[model samples]
Target: MDMDNFREMFLTEAAEHLQLMVDLLVQLDSDPQDQDGIDALFRGAHSIKGMAASMEYPETARLAHHLEDHLADCRQLGQISGVEIDWLLEAVDLLELLLGDIRNGRPERNVDSFIAGISKQPEAAVDCVAETKTVELTACGRGQLIQLQLQESVAIPGPRFLVLLKKLADLGTILESTPSTEDLLQGDAPNQLLVRL
Candidate 1:
């Protein structure tokens, strides 16, 4: 198989492994002492790590490694907490985002915050969802008003909107935005976004 074929295979397998991890995490949440579930979770992360490394996706591999290491620690402890499971589930969400980036042939989203949060205690894991980005404001003046509408098939719109804003900010200053940057960071999924650039 060619590289594109390999990439397609990798994307399919990685998505399956991620879904399995989510299911396992849900099970673990109910029965934290389920040794079998813990082992499966660890294996899932390890599998993604190895596959991503082979595919030369460094960000995906690194994120998977962090998850694998965390699961290994949980295995050593012989039990996982609900808080830890919730954190892992969030990590899985981020992994899915990374997978989407890979599938789209786009650069990987920033994973540093997620990695840093995982490195800390479970209570701190939620910090990764809170981005520290600030919208740049320029002198008040008339600017090009651009409106964007995400496709109906888009599963997640908040991140895509933020990406659009970031790219627009690079081209020119943003005067205003519907839903606001704060709303987007807080997980608002508006179908349409208006920006004055």
Candidate 2:
């Protein structure tokens, strides 16, 4: 396949496999010793490996294969933990980096050093995209947003929130409040206080 066609194909497959792995990892986080979760992760890693290799990206394939191996070992040992999850996340990150290299016209890289550094760190804090976006103020969801920056120590945020809440209660019917009107009045929220009508 030509470079453009090959890249598109690889990206689609990689995204699918990555999503599968991410879902499995989230499940594993909830239940560390889930057999199915482990299997799912292994399958995802394996698929990524095959796809990468076929796309002529040896570095990507190798890294995925290594991750698959580690997961296989975990299966044999019958345990997986936070640290292992961290290691896997690091491996995934390395694979992403290699993929980026390939996409950018640079040669794909062997990220063994990046993989090795995971062990030294001990805990891998994976960066996950936010699950739900803060909804925009829709037609029915009309309410004033009270945002307060702590840079200026004007007054207690609670009092400020209460003043805002009172102002909001006057505008229209207060359909739903996130932290409850009472709680907000008690100075519970911070930085941003949103009221959705």
The candidate scoring highest on lDDT is 1
Residue 112 of model 1, lDDT score: 93
The digit string of per-residue lDDT tens for model 2 on 1-197 reads 67799788887778777756755664575578899889889888999999988888888888888788888988887778865764565466566667668778899876777667644745423222112224556665465443323212222234334444554566777666656767854547464456664
Q: How many backbone clashes does every candidate have?
A: 0, 0
For all predictions, the C-alpha RMSD in Å is 11.6, 13.6
Model 2 misplaced stretches (Cα beyond 4 Å): 1-3, 117-197
lDDT (C-alpha, whole model) for all candidates = 0.78, 0.64
Alpha-carbon deviation at 165 in model 1, angstroms? 34
| 39-149: candidate 1 lDDT, tens digit per residue | 999999999999999999999999999999999999999999866875776677788888989999999888998788766666742232323233333465566667677
* TM-score for all models, in order of appearance: 0.63, 0.58
Q: What lDDT score is found at residue 32 in candidate 2?
A: 85
Instruction: Score candidate 1 by TM-score against the native.
Output: 0.63
